[model samples]
Target: MIKIDAMMVCLDLSDIDEKLVAFSRTICERMQVGKVYFVHNIKLYELGDDFREMFGDVDLAQEVEGNINDIVDEQFANKTAYEVLVSEEPNTEVILADLVKRYNIKLTLLGKKMSTKSTGSLGTKLLRILPCSVLVFPETASFNIQKVLVPIDFSDTSVHALRLSKNLSDQLGLQLEIMHVYRLPSQFFPLISEEKAVRKAEEVVKGKFADLQKRHNEIAGIPYTLVRAANKSIAERISLHLEKGRHDLLVLGLKGNNPLPSLSLGSVPTEMYNTDINVPLWLVYSEEVIK
Candidate 1:
């Protein structure tokens, strides 16, 4: 499990704010988090002279802070220790990085705008920079965790993801499923038939999974699916399986096998982050992977 001593949540005063706040509260309560930081960044362009004149003496930061406080109070009810931060820093990623370091935050919560007319560039950027794990809640996310789907590549990063998902499932009484998407090598594809290639690939994947289960005994008895990437990319296959399985959450690792020291996000994670999967996604990061 990720040691969530302190966590930060980014709010934009949209309809998803309430749901994100409620979800964070539930996580804090269940995980016994120490502190919560609710942050909202105001762009410099929004603080222009015309806006100031129109709003007449209203403190944008205070108003935003007050709004966040109301939601926190309503959802948390003074149970969890939290602070509301409103900044006009213009650079949200910078503000979030500073806050994460200053507060010793181990996890960050972000909302993915699915139905809203907004591109989630900030969330994508932070996934590359933030020195902690991130849980992105989609707009349609419910306040329940009935089932979780984890996509793995048999790397150490993916092993950590599976272990954490297993721990969470055991603690919360939720169902867990593991998915491994495999592809045949193009060079070998021309030499042999597609049917033989698929069988060979599945055999190799099954051996790796057996070894993984043996090493990580916590994931025993947990069901997993091996999918062959026929025409779609590995990320697309996982997304399709997620919808088909009706999984409530999708958990993934930030880094994959043989990742460069400077590369924080993997290719599959990048693709999934941009796609609207209509489910909450949790990107788990081990301590060694945090830059």
Candidate 2:
């Protein structure tokens, strides 16, 4: 049984709203998460000198703590039991990682805008270092998991993501859709036509998918699709598919076929993270398998 004892939520006070809190609550209810930790890190420098001077004698930390409590009360009032942690750490990512370890967090939820401004550096770093899975919600996304899309590449990370997605689908009665995007070689000896190249790529993808199904027969009964396009980036193809399929959630493995043990974030997943896809994305990282 997969046990998710606690969930950690990183809240940006600049954009605290009821919808974001509601989304977090919905996920907690769906995942049956017991305890929710709401964490916010304050950059002392960002607090203007005037503000600091005004509260110089007073404990600015306490004032920030009160503000966080008020926000929680306004948003999650009586909805769920949660604890708030306010830190003055300059590096919010470090603070978040420490909290995750301290709380043994199983999942980290983050709300981010679908704009270039939101680099998602904190979420990305946590996904790389933390043992827990990271769930990123685009500002416009709702906490819905009706139909899930998992892109696989036949690697251990992909397999781990597939397994987890299957488990979630089974538990939540969600429609699971598996897809594999392939690119044909740019130059072939005979210079095959585009149509023939596409056909060949489809055959290869189907064969690999079939082999995966055979390996995991128990969950292989679900529907899977093959996407083939020449000279197109995987992230671009994935974005197109998400737009067309209207999948509520995208489950992705954190690392690809990179042999480097220190390369925490895979290129594909990172690109997807940076993209402005307006769907909730679940980044799965298998610590045991990856290490």
lDDT by residue for model 1 (1-291), tens: 535789899898989898888999889777868889999998967567988778887777888888888998887664778888898897888889889999989889999887356787778888877778899998877778799999999988988888889889887889999999998887775779988888888999999989987997878799999998978999999989988999999999977234552366888888898888878899988887665
lDDT of 1 at 187: 76
TM-score of 2: 0.90
Candidate 1 Cα RMSD after full superposition onto the native fold (Å): 2.2
Candidate topping TM-score: 1
- Per-prediction TM-score, please? 0.93, 0.90
lDDT per residue as tens, model 2, 1-291:
355788887777666345567777677666667788877788887878898677776776677678777877776654456898888888877778788878988788877775656667666676666656788888878666699999989998899999999989888889999888887777683677878888888888888888888999866698887887546789889989988999999999876234553476687888898888888989887867433
**Model 1, position 289: C-alpha lDDT score:** 68
Count: clashes, candidate 1: 0
Q: Model 2: clashing residue pairs?
A: none
Backbone clash pairs for candidate 1 read none
